[model samples]
Target: MATDPIEQFQISNWIPIEIGGLDFSFSNASAFMVVTAVSASAFLYLTTSSRGLVPGRLQSISEMTYEFIASMLREAAGSKGMRFFPLVFSLFVFILVANLLGVFPYFFTVTSHIIVTFALALLVVGTVIIYGFYKHGFGFLKLFVPEGVPGALVPLVVAIEIVSFLSRPVSLSVRLFANMLAGHITLKVFAGFVTTLSAFGLAGAAGAVLPLAMTIAITALEVLVAFLQAYVFAVLTCMYLNDAVNPSH
Candidate 1:
């Protein structure tokens, strides 16, 4: 039987374990997350280990990635925000690699799941909230009050601001999750058509050509989307952190 296209995304337990009525199975999704992290680390390590005077291609890529995040942080969060360089950079690299990995034949796309993306979004927002309160104390509350609002409108504006602030995680997480899920599903559907059509005789083989072309095109587009989604996530993270760093704005 031909494999179901959606079955590619089904999570399977590689090592099942239950403790105190809690299932803590080591799943394929979890495995791929580890793979993504390890691959990213290895890439960074190997690319920068030499530190040659004339940078190799890998070194140049590593350096460019560093500068890109640095520049993004500086622009969004300012000089003091550079303190969170490690945090932002790691998030960027991890998401970017995880996305890129999913482009491969058998890799799982972690960010395609709402739970994973929401957790990441929560991390970003949680960090901002914690740092904001810790750094600015009561002053962090000013984030909800606009500078030019009249006293009469302050209450209404503050309420609106609070709702908008709370929605950040939802927006951020859904954007990434929806994009990855849609892109992958579309690719799988087209690829499956190619396989299904090719199973017939000569006419079927000929019919598979269109879907094959679409599959290739979508594959290339997904690669760009993977990078774009990662960038969007990282940039928004920086912008949120900036609010924590400078809450008055």
Candidate 2:
């Protein structure tokens, strides 16, 4: 029998815990998330610890990643937005590492879950809103009310802007979650096809070639997607931060 493609995403509790009738069990998802965070932090720390005069391969990688995100944030939000460098950098590293880790066999994809991605989206949007209000005071409301709008159309434009702003989190979370989930499922299905077909005989094994090829292709594509999705998330985050910093625009 072919393995179920969806089985890969099933969350299993590793260490069950309950407090005040709440299920707070440590799960496979939790474990991988911890692994992702620790691995990314350790990689960055170890790679950059020496700060060699002439950069080694590891140090070069670390430097490149830093510069990439730094340049991206600077471009998206401007120099003033560099104030949130730590937040934006951390998010990029975390999501990038988590997505890459999920590519490994038996590893749980943390961002594939809607809840996980949603929580991350909420964090970004929440930061934008809180900082927008704090720094700009009521001036942040200008984000929804653009300059040079005629009096009659002002209400309509404001309503549209408000809806679009509110929908950011939903769109952001769903983009990441859906992409990761669909890619993994497709990979799993093709892989299962290869395995099931190979078991029959010489003829079956020959037929398995197509699915095997597809599985390999999808795996490579998924790796690219892992990085792409991370970049997309970080880029959107910077753009949103720009709104907070310069609400009038």
Candidate 3:
């Protein structure tokens, strides 16, 4: 009867399917992920379909997004890393759209799940590892060893670096997942308070005012956060790619 904030996060099976004991059913989360990807793709295509001398509003926004990610990769990873523009851009768009979509009622937040975020993080790390070894061969190991460390402390520093490097995916995934999860949960709690307080008479209506205001403010903040988290993810990915490109640092 009462609203449960946590209920929103529960994954429910939409179209069940099982083969070879594997549960690969389509779910609300999966549907939303598809929607996010399709929506982003459609937006880009529609916005850029007509190449006008003077850009329209949608075209301007699309070009701005492209330039923004391009600038970020150039700053973090240099021009050589521009080859990864597609990967980084798609990632940023997907996360950004998914996050913003989740802010709407009845939309599932895919990034809030550890599995989804971890997969994305692992993809970035995996690309770094694969490309690093492919490009630099044994030199990739140098990423774990700094140049200025004392000879005596080299082993300790390398050990620390190794731990830190291995923890990248975990940290990256958890950062996105935790932020989305906490933000949505806090929002739901405040929103629930507004709903609960509305049942009272005049006093109840007055009580709902503060929580309603807080919810509105948090919604605005969450919109900013959606873009920020996506940008942060893209920047970090570029930085990691830079290491793979030049392991000497």
Candidate 4:
């Protein structure tokens, strides 16, 4: 199992802890999550702390990210959506940083796990449901009942909408988890091919060329997937929050 492609994802406890019979051990996954959060926070803080008149590269990147999320939220949920800007921006940065960090060798991809992604998905859904009811009261239920549905078909449409709404967390979590898991597994398998073949001497080294190229190509693709997944998660979040802000249809 030492060289298994899936072995890279195995969690190892660095500091095992048991509290009231509950396992709360600090494992590799937890450590990487902490690292991701700190790295992202520190980068944004340091880069923009200067408030430069003429922006540097890091500062420019930070500002672009801010504007990107701002524009996305505004477009999806309108001016009212700006209220959730801090939450949306934080989630976007956190997931983006975590995904990118996982692209490096020996880094753990926390987003690859269903549990982590599901928890994040739940948070967004929870916020939507809570805010929807709080802001609009019973009017939030209007989200499930389309405006133009015939009276007889309203029941069927409402049932379908309810099912779809309930499935958001499932779909959101699986999309990120599956993408990260599959990409990493494919990359690892090709990488292992490169290593195993190189050990077989000159003939095998020459034969390893294809797998080596594939490994590189997949690595580049994974980097793009990392960014894309984060953006997708963030944009979907904006749309969901829009339902809470304007639950008309």
Candidate 5:
């Protein structure tokens, strides 16, 4: 029987590798997270180790990545957003690396899991809440009130806006997770068609080629999707931060 490609996404079981009745087994997701962090560190180290005026290829790529995030922040969140350049840039690179790295053979996509994405989303939303409250005091509550609305309707309007504000993290996280999950599953399903069709005759062989082609094409597209997904995640973060810093926007 053929394996279900979707089942390949399962999180590894917790083993009883116990220390004083506490179970801790290295999971596939955890391994990927470690790998993602190490890979990011190594990339940064190698790229910046030579502080020469003349640029190297790796250094150029790293610089470009940083500038890209900076540009996005300035464009989306404005000059006030520069204060967050470091955080936004780091986030963009980290997520980009984790996503692109998962495309390799025998590797897991940490971002495909809801737990990981939701955690990240929570951090973004949490930062917004904390920063907004600290910066604006009780005026942060005014985020839910539109400027042009009548005082009579303010209560009902605020209630709706509050729900919308709370939904940001879920919507943000689910967007990335759902896209990555769907992309990988679609790739796997197309690849599987090649296997199933090859068992038939020449027409089957002929037909099998199409799915193989599609799989290859989608793989390339998924690479683009990976980058775009990372971009989307970072941009949304900037937008959320903007709403925090300048809540009236």
Candidate 6:
């Protein structure tokens, strides 16, 4: 049977089960998220526990991943911001794993779904807001107010700051979802071309070769995109944390 590429994106279904008198339906995206969380935890536990002085290959790789995230956080949020290394590291690895999982031939890439990405974005952005308020109390409200604003322009600048802050999740989620969706769609379309061309005569078969080659190239590019989108997500989280730590004005 021919697969519906559009249908592949569907994530919801009604389940009869109820929890606390509330109906709950399991979703494909939800399953993927659970899998991502478990796999990430198990991976870290297994790799970190088998420690070596110099480090085994797996230990080295896992430590490298940890250092990569720690270094990125330090770079963005600084040493003072280093307190968030655990949060930032988990964010980076979870996202990187989720993104790469989608590149496999049949697995649904949860990150390609806007809702999943949006949820993650909201969590990160929400963390920044909550922590900012917790650490600074009412003074965190000053984040939306530029100190040097003239009396006449203070209201306008504050409004702009609030709007920008609210838009963070929208921008962050859309970037990952859009990039993954577009890359996968383009890849599927090219693969379809290879299929259609193979049915024609020898001349048509010859033309099929180039599309197949392009498909291979696109697959490699998609792998890079997977890694980059994860990096971008982690970095943006760090930037937001920085803003919470020290308001620009």
Question: Per-residue lDDT of 1-249 in model 5, one digit per residue for the tens?
Answer: 354678647888444356778757778887888889899989988898997688799999888888888888998879987888878887787788888987775578989899889999999899899999999998887788889998899999989999998999999899989988998888888888988898888888899999999999998998998999899999999999988788875
Give the C-alpha lDDT of model 2: 0.94
lDDT of all the models against the reference? 0.93, 0.94, 0.93, 0.95, 0.86, 0.84
Kindly report which residue stretches of model 3 are placed more than 4 angstroms away from their true locations once superposed: none
lDDT of 1 by residue, 51-166 (tens): 98899999999999999999999999999999999999999999999899998877888888899999999999999999999999999999999899989999999999999999
Better of 1 and 6 by TM-score: 1
lDDT tens digits by residue: candidate 4, 7-117: 888999999999999989999999999999999989999999999999999999999999999999999999998999999999999899989999998899999999999
Report how far off residue 103 is in candidate 4 (Å). Answer: 0.7
The total of clashing pairs for model 5 equals 0
Q: lDDT (0-100) at residue 111 of candidate 6?
A: 88
Candidate 3 lDDT tens digits, 1-249: 347888888899999989999999999998999999999999999999998789999999999999999999998888888888899999999999999999997789989999999999999999999999999999999999999888999999999999999999999999999989999998999999999999888899899999999999999988988988998899899999999888998
Model 5 Cα displacement at 1 (Å)? 5.9
Candidate 2, poorest ten consecutive residues by summed lDDT: 1-10
lDDT (0-100) at residue 65 of candidate 6?
A: 89
For candidate 5, list the clashing residue pairs, or say none.
Answer: none
Compute the lDDT for candidate 6: 0.84
Task: Show how many residue pairs clash in every candidate, following the order shown.
Answer: 0, 0, 0, 0, 0, 0
Model 6 error, position 219 (Å): 1.1
The 10 consecutive residues of candidate 6 with the worst lDDT sum are: 1-10
How far off is residue 22 in model 1, in Å?
Answer: 1.6
Best by lDDT: 4
Model 1 bad stretches (over 4 Å):
1-3
Ranking of all predicted structures according to TM-score, beginning with the best and ending with the worst: 4, 3, 2, 1, 5, 6
